[model samples]
Target chain A: MSTPARLQPGDTIGILGGGQLGRMLAQSAAKMGLKTHIYCPDPGSPAFDVSNTFTVAPYEDADALDRFAAAVDVVTYEFENVPGPTASRLHAKVPVRPGVRALEISQDRLFEKQYLTKASVDIAGFAEINSQEDLDQALQKFNGKGVLKTRRFGYDGKGQLMIRSSADGNGAYAALGSVPAVLEQLIAFECEVSVIVARSLDGTCVSYDIARNHHENHILKTSTVPAGVTAETLNTARRMAEQIVTGLEYVGVMGVEMFLLQEDGEERLLVNEIAPRVHNSGHWTQDACLTSQFDQHIRAVAGWPLGSAQRHSDAVMENLIGFEADEWHAALSDPNACLHLYGKSETREGRKMGHVNHIKAKALTEGET
Target chain B: MSTPARLQPGDTIGILGGGQLGRMLAQSAAKMGLKTHIYCPDPGSPAFDVSNTFTVAPYEDADALDRFAAAVDVVTYEFENVPGPTASRLHAKVPVRPGVRALEISQDRLFEKQYLTKASVDIAGFAEINSQEDLDQALQKFNGKGVLKTRRFGYDGKGQLMIRSSADGNGAYAALGSVPAVLEQLIAFECEVSVIVARSLDGTCVSYDIARNHHENHILKTSTVPAGVTAETLNTARRMAEQIVTGLEYVGVMGVEMFLLQEDGEERLLVNEIAPRVHNSGHWTQDACLTSQFDQHIRAVAGWPLGSAQRHSDAVMENLIGFEADEWHAALSDPNACLHLYGKSETREGRKMGHVNHIKAKALTEGET
Candidate 1:
C-alpha cells in the first residue's frame, strides 16, 4: 500500500489473473519498456506467452505471492474475483493499484451497488436477496419482473437470470438454486453503452468517447463509436464515470456500463456495472483512437499520463466469440477489417477469442436528437 | 514448398530477421494463433524473446537454415539486406513470401536503381564508380556535386560521402576504401516521401497513403500523415511504387523512397530507394488505421488478403533513437502519444530503439488548396 503513486519504465509490473485483459496489459507494458510478471493458476494462460515472468500458483499461495510481490515494483489485476484473503495478502506487501477496496466492491455485485449508492451514482431500481424468502420480498417490491444475478464470480451473462412474471420469478430463483442474488427491474431502454475512464493518483481523470454497445445473451457482441448519444448525454456520461473513479480513488482504467433509458423523450443513463479492468467495448480504441485502453492502463499503472482518450475515427468493434474466431484468415484478408485474434488455441462456444476493429472516416450524418 | 495458402490455426511461421520489425511481425503472428520461429544471429535480439522457437545461427549457417525451414510452414524476412545466398538457401526449402527476387534487387543500391530504371520508373541521375577514373568522369559530368555511396550495406548515412568541389572529390575515392560504389547526383527536392505497398502472392497490391517523412543525419526522425503533398503527387507516388512492385512480382510490404522534385514549379517524384519490408514511416498506421503494417506483413506472408491500408487519423511518428527510447515513461504519459519500445536493453547513438506515434483526427480543416 506504500508503493509510489507513479511507476517508472524498467519497473516490474505484477499482474494478477492472466486473462485476455492481462495478456494485453502485459503486451502494452512491454511496449512501454516496463516488465510484467503474470500470476495466474493456469500454467497455460495466454498471458504467459508474452510475459517476462509468470507464476503458476493458487491465489492463496502466500509463498508465491511473496516472491511475485518482491520481484515486481507494483501490482495490478485484470479480474476483480480475487478472494478477500488474496487481496489482503497482496496489499500487505505490494502496492496494488485500484486497491483492495475497489476489488472488494467490484468482486461482488451487491457490494458494488452499495458502494455506488454511497457515492451517489445512479443505478436502476434493485433489491438484494440472501435467500429465497428475500427473493420473494424483492419480487413483491419490484412486481417480480426483473433480472436476478448472483452476488459474486459472475461475468458476461453468467450467474444471471431474467424473470418475466411472478411465476417466472419464483421459477428463476429456484433454477438458480436460491443463491444470494440481486434483482433489478430491467430498463426498457434503447441501447447499452460504456465509458472507459482512467484515474491517476493526482486525480487526473480522462474518459474515452462513448461506445454504443450490443450484447448477445448478455455477452458483448459489438461496439460502435461516435455513439448516437446527445452531446448532453455524452457529457453526463463522462461526469458520472469521473464521479465513480474519483470516489474510488481508482488507478488504471475502469469501464462503466450504462443503459440509455428513453421514456417520454426524457433520456437517462442508468449505471449497469463497472469493469475494474479494460472492457470489451473499449477494444475499438486499439485502432480507432490515439491510445487504446490497454495502453492507457499501462500508462496509468506506470504512472504515465493518461492518453488523450479521444476517438480519431468512426469505428466498429466486433467480438470474436466461439467459432467466429476461426474466420481469422478471412478477417485478415479483408482489407477493411483490423483483426485481433487472441492466441487461444481452442474456440469454445461463448468464449472470447479475439476481436476485429473496423475504423473509417467519420461520415457526416444528420445529428441525432 | 507444398504449403497451402490457407493455413489453419496452430501453424508455425518462420521469420528470417531478428530486428524490431521482425519482433513486431512475430507479435502479430502470435496474436493470430500461429507460432513463430525467429531466425537471427543475435541471441539478444528482441524477437527471440516473444517467439516459440529460434535458431541463433547466422543466415549462412546451412544447418540452421535447413532446420529453420524444417521447423516452420513459410519464411519471411524484415529487411532487404539479407544476402542472396542466404535467401536462396532458405527459399530452396520453403515458400518465401515477397520472394528472393525482391531481396536480390533491393540488397544493392546500384542494382535497385538499375532495376527501377529498367522497369521504367523515374530515378535520380546516377553512375557506377568502378574506378577512380570513372569517379572523375562522373564528377566532371556532375559539375561537382554528388553522393558517393558503397553499393552494398549502407544505411543511416553510413558508407557514404559527399563530393562538392574538386578537392573533396579528389579524396572521396580513397574515402570509400576501395569498395564498389555508385555516384549519384544530389537532386534538389522539395520533400522526401515513401509509398508502402503490399503485394499478395496472387499479385494483388494495396498501397497506403503516401507519408511525408523527415530525416535527421540520414536516419528517419519523424513521419507525418497526409504528407504535405497534393492529390496529384500522391497518385504519382503510388503509381511509381506500383511500377516497381509489379516489375519484381514482389509480395508483402515494400517501401519505395522517392524525392519530390519541383522543377519549374511542377512537382514530380524521383525514385530514390526501395525497402523490401515494412518501413518506419508506416508505423503510425498501427494506431491511425484499421490494420498496421506489421499486421499486414503477417497477413501477406501467411497468404492472407492484405488488410485495408486506409488512414483514419493524421499521425506523427517519431523514431526514438538510442537514449531517446529512455523517454518511454514521459512519452507513455502523453495522452496523444502511443509509446512503442522495442525491447532492446542497450542504448547507443543513432540506433533506432523504438518509436512513439502521436495521432489526431483527420477532419479536413478550412483551407484553400
Candidate 2:
C-alpha cells in the first residue's frame, strides 16, 4: 500500500469516545494547531470542553459516523470499546490509528491471548468458555482458581467473575451472563505494571519506561515510574510491547498491562492485557516526561514521526476517584504535585475524577527492585 | 470581607480576551474540572476552540458582559487591555480576579510606573508627556535618547516611537498620534527578564523562577529559565514581584518585566512594566516547572491556594511567529521538546503562532552566564 501524505498541523482529527483521555488528547492535538471533533453519545462528556466541535450520537449511528469521518482527515479513539462495525465504517473513510486489528484483539480477551500466544509472547494460560462445561474444564486447568472475563466489552475490572474454587464454577459462569468468556489462570504475581508504547505510520515504535501500578477495588489507584524492575525484566517488557504493537500494525499509542512475577533473583513479566489507546497507568508521563503519551498518540495518529518516550523526572501518580478529588485544595498548595482533573459533571463512586503527579528530579534514586 | 468560598471543581470561570493566552488558560481550567467562558470581539479567537462556551462580542457590550458574569462563578481575563468599566461591571456581578486595580494600573504604562515607584521599586527614568514640549523636556533628562510610548492600549512594540535626539522630539510626538504618552530613558541593559507570580484570595503568594527574555523586532522571541543571573538578582526579582502583587492586592497571576543591567560587577534590575495576566515569557513554565503559570492563574482566580512554583528542569522557550510554526513536523519527533501552538487558522507576520520548550533535567549544568 502506498503511504498517505502526513497530516498538516491544521488538519482535523476525529476522535471516538469522549472522556478524560479524549479531553487530554484533544488538548494535545490543539497544542499542535490541530483541531479535534469528538463524537460521543454523552452530551456531558468532558472532552467536549476542549474540542473544536463534537457530535452527540450513539457510536452505532452510521450516518453520524460517516459525516464525522468525512469531515476529518484522520480518525482515532480514546477507548477500545468502540463497536467493530462503527470502526470498520470509519476506517473505510479515514485512517484509524491503532488499526481495527488492535481494537478487535483488545476488545476480546480470547483474541488478545491468542495473538500474544501466536507471537510467542508470555501470557497467563487462558481457555475459551462458551458454556458451563467449558468453565468446568477450564477450572480443572487452574486448580479451580481463575478469572472468567467476557470476551468483549470489559473494563475497569467489570464484566469479569473470579473463581476461588471448583464450587464457584457454575455460579461464576452464570455471573458472566452466559456470554462467551475466557478463563485466565490465577497467577500469584509480585506486582502489576504497564508500558505505554507509540507506533508511527512508518512502523517506528517507542515505549516509555515501565510503570508499577497499585489497584484498589479493581481500579488503578497509583502508578510509579521506573517500576523498580531489573533492567533485564524492563527490557523484556518493552520488547513485548513493541512486538505486540508491531503484530497489530498499530499506528498510535497502546498500553500493555503486565504482571511482574518474582522468581528468586529473576523477574518474569506475564502479559495481562492490552488497551489499544492511552491508558490510565501512563498518566504520569504528562508531568514526568517531555513528550506526554497523549502528545505521542496524536503524533502517531496524524502520521507524524514518533516522539521520544524518555522521561525526565521520577514521579508517583495517584488517581482521585469520586470524592477523593475533594483533596484538590491540598494538591493546589503542593509544590511538587501536578494536578489534572477531568471536567466531570459529578463525582460518582469508582469514577475517576482526576489524578495528581508528584514529580521529583531524576537525581532521586530509583526504587530498589 | 469574609473570604469568598473557594471555587469547587464544577465552577465556571469567565475569561475576557479570547487569544492564545486565554486558550491556554481555558485548557488549564478544564484540567481542574472547571468550565470556562471566553468573551472577545474576534469571532476567530483561538480560545473559543478550548472553552466550554464563548461570546463573540465587544467587551463594551453590556448585555453580553452581564449575561457572561451571571453564568460564571468568577471572572478573570487573559490580557490587561480589558476595558476598566467592563471589569467593574463583571466585578459587580461576579468576583473579577486581580481586581480592577490591576487592569487600571497595567493598562496604562504611566500608572504602572507610578505604582512601582510608590511601592519603592526601581524603574527606568520616565516622564509623562502630553505634547512635543513634554517630550523634549523628557529627552533632556536622557541625553536625547528615549522611547515614546502611548500610555494605554499598546503591546508588541506598537504605539511607540524612538526619540534618538532632541531634534526628533516633534516627529516622535506626531508618530505616537500626539496622544498622552510616557517617555522612558533608554538604558543600556544587559538583558530583559520576567518574573511570574500568583497571589491567592487569602493572600498566599507563589512565584516562578526568573525567565530571561530575548526580543526581535520589539517582540519577545525566546525565554530561558534560570536567567543566568546571580542569586541576588533572582531573589530581588522575586521580591519585586511579590511586592507588586501585594501592593496591588492582586488575586491572580501577573508577569513583571524588568531590565537587568550590570554595573561594577553587580546586577541592577529596572522594572519595565507589568502584564496583569499570564505572559509570553512564562511559557517555559509549562515544561520546566511543576505548575505552569496558566495553572497557577486559574487556581488563584478561582480562590484556590497558589500551587508550587518550583522548577524541576532548565528550559529554553522559543516562539514560532507566523509561518515559523510550519516546522511543527520537526518538533513532533524531538524528544526533549514540548510544542504548544495556538489554534490560529492563519499565519500573519509577527502573530504568535506557537512556541517550543526544550527542557533538560536540573541535573544538567547551568549555561554560562
Q: Could you say which candidate leads in TM-score? A: 2
TM-score for each candidate, following the candidate numbering: 0.94, 0.95
lDDT by residue (B10-119, candidate 2, tens digit) is 88999999989999999899888899999999999999998889999988999999899888888889888888889888888788888899899988989989999999
Give the alpha carbon lDDT tens digit for every residue of B65-136 in model 1. 888888888888988788888888778788887889888877787888889989898887999997888899
Clashing pairs in 1: A305-B333, A307-B335, A308-B335, A335-B308
DockQ (Cα-based) for each candidate:
0.43, 0.40
Query: Each candidate: what lDDT?
Result: 0.82, 0.87
Any runs in candidate 2 off by more than 4 Å, and if so which? A1-5, A170-175, A362-369, B1-5, B362-369
lDDT of 1: 0.82
Candidate 2 to truth, TM: 0.95
Model 2 docking tier (incorrect/acceptable/medium/high): acceptable
Error of 2 at A152 (Å): 2.1
- TM-score chain B for all models: 0.95, 0.96
